[model samples]
Target: MKIGVLALQGDFDAHRKRLEELGAEVVLVKKPEQLDDIAGLVIPGGESSTFLNLLGKEGFAKLKGFVRMKPTFGTCAGAILLANEVENPKQVGLGALDITIRRNAYGRQVDSSIREGQFLHDPIEMVFIRAPKIERLGKDVEVVATEGRDPVMVRKGNTLAATFHPELSDDSRIHQYFLDLVTNGKH
Candidate 1:
């Protein structure tokens, strides 16, 4: 299956490499039209505000529509963009996941760290880079993984999101889970 990684900014290349490692065809999508060519999409972590401007009105509109229809995974800033509500400077999102997110709740770049979290009942290393935190989960949202008492990874139907950079880690399970969503639609 073909997966498109938003290459506008952030660690998209890392996500692309991870998807490729899993034996999936990867596309580095820089334009909104590219969304039509993929089965699923990965929105990488980066400056959320910058991403908004980069996406422009048309691109953002296209993205907002795509996420609602396709199996989409958003990481960190991407998570912010997918949230129904955003704190620490609220911003509009795709509204794909019914949850609230607090941007940079883990502090700034200097406070970044590597930690461990549970995924699929297994230990997975988590890399946090100015990560956001899930403030609330709607009825349909599932907590896939957590760091301490806060959810770091969550899912709602075809939408999966993470506050941490799973692409930076060696574990591909998270990506694989997203792949499952892409292939199977839902559990």
Candidate 2:
């Protein structure tokens, strides 16, 4: 299956590499129309406001529709973009995931860190770089991974979100989970 990585900014190439290693076809998605050629999409970590500015009105609207129709995964800033609500200076979001996210909730860039987290019922390393925190989850949202008491990874329908940069980690389990969602057509 082909998975598209939103390559507007951030560490999108890392995601592409990870997916390719997992034996999946990868697409570097820039324009909204690229969404149609892939089975799933990954919105990579980047500056949230910057991503919004880059997306503009047309791209943002197109993404909104694409998220509703397919399995999409958003990490860090991408999580912020998919959130229903954003704080630390409120911002517009795609509203694909029913959650509230606080941008830079882990602190400034200086506070970026690596931590051990729980995922797939096992311990996994997580990388957080100016990451947005998943503040709250909706009733239908399932907590798939967590860092201590906080929900770091969540799933709602076909949309998956994480507060950390899984692309920065060596593990492929998270991406594989999303891939399963893509192949199963869970949306």
Candidate 3:
């Protein structure tokens, strides 16, 4: 299956490489038209506000529409964009997933860390770099994993979101899970 990674900014390259390693056709999506050719999309971690600014109105609207019709996975700041509500003010998002996110909830970039946690069916090494935390989840949202007392991974319908960077880690389970979602016609 072909999966697209939003290459507007952030760690899109890491995600692209990971998905490719998983044997999926990886597409680097820069323009709006590229969004149509992929079965699924991944929005990587970056500055949420800056990423939003880069999208402008047209790009943002198109992305929102695409997420509604396909399987989408978002990480870190990307997770914030997918949420229905954004905490810590500056409210900006695509509202693709029914949830609330708080930016930099884990502290600053200097406070970034790597922690081991069980997400899904395996132990995952999570890298939290100024990541947002899932604060409030909707009824349809299923908490897939957690870091201590906080929810780190959550899924709603065909959309999946994580507060940490799984691409940066050795584990490819998350990407594989997303691929499974697409291949299984979950979207």
Candidate 4:
């Protein structure tokens, strides 16, 4: 199956390499039209608002439509984009996940850190870089991973989101889980 990584900004290459390492065909999706070519999509970490500006009206609309139908995994700013409600000066989002996300809740770039989190039954290393915080989860949303009491990774239906950069770490489980999700056609 072909997996597309939103490559307009952020560390998209990392996700691409990680997905490729996991034995899936990878696409660096720089255009909205590329969405039609992939079975699943990975929206990488970046400045959320800039993602909006970069996507513009047409691209953003295309993305919003795609996420609702395809399996999508989003990290950092990508998570912000997938949220239903955005905080820290609220902004519009794709509304793919029933979540309230607060941008940069983990502090700034200088404050970024490598932390441990529980991913389902396993302990995983999570890289947080100007990360957002999952403030509230709607009833349908399930916590897939957490750092302390805060949810770092969450999912609902075909949409999966992470406040941390799973691709930045050596662990392949998170990406693997997403692959499994795509493979099994699970939410």
Candidate whose TM-score is highest: 4
Clashes of 3: 0
lDDT of 1 by residue, 1-187 (tens): 8999999989999999999999999999998899999999999998989899999999999999999899999999889999989999989888899999998897888999999888766788999998888989999899999877778899988899999999999888899889988999986
Estimated TM-score per prediction? 0.97, 0.97, 0.96, 0.97
Which tens-of-lDDT digit does each residue in 34-97 have in candidate 2? Answer: 9889888999998889999989999999999999989999999889999989999899999998
Instruction: Please state the error at residue 57 of candidate 1 in Å.
Output: 0.9
TM-score of 1: 0.97
User: In candidate 1, which residue ranges exceed 4 Å CA deviation?
Assistant: none
Candidate that would win on lDDT:
4
lDDT of 3 by residue, 126-163 (tens): 99999888889889899888888788999988889999
**Residue pairs of candidate 2 with colliding backbone atoms:** none
Off by more than 4 A, model 2:
none
Give the distance in Å from residue 13's predicted Cα in candidate 3 to where it truly belongs. Answer: 0.5
At residue 175, what lDDT does model 4 achieve? 97
Sliding window of 10 residues with minimal summed lDDT for model 2:
178-187
RMSD of each: 0.9, 1.3, 1.3, 0.9
In order of listing, the candidates' clash counts read: 0, 0, 0, 0
lDDT of each: 0.91, 0.90, 0.89, 0.94
lDDT of 4 at 61: 97
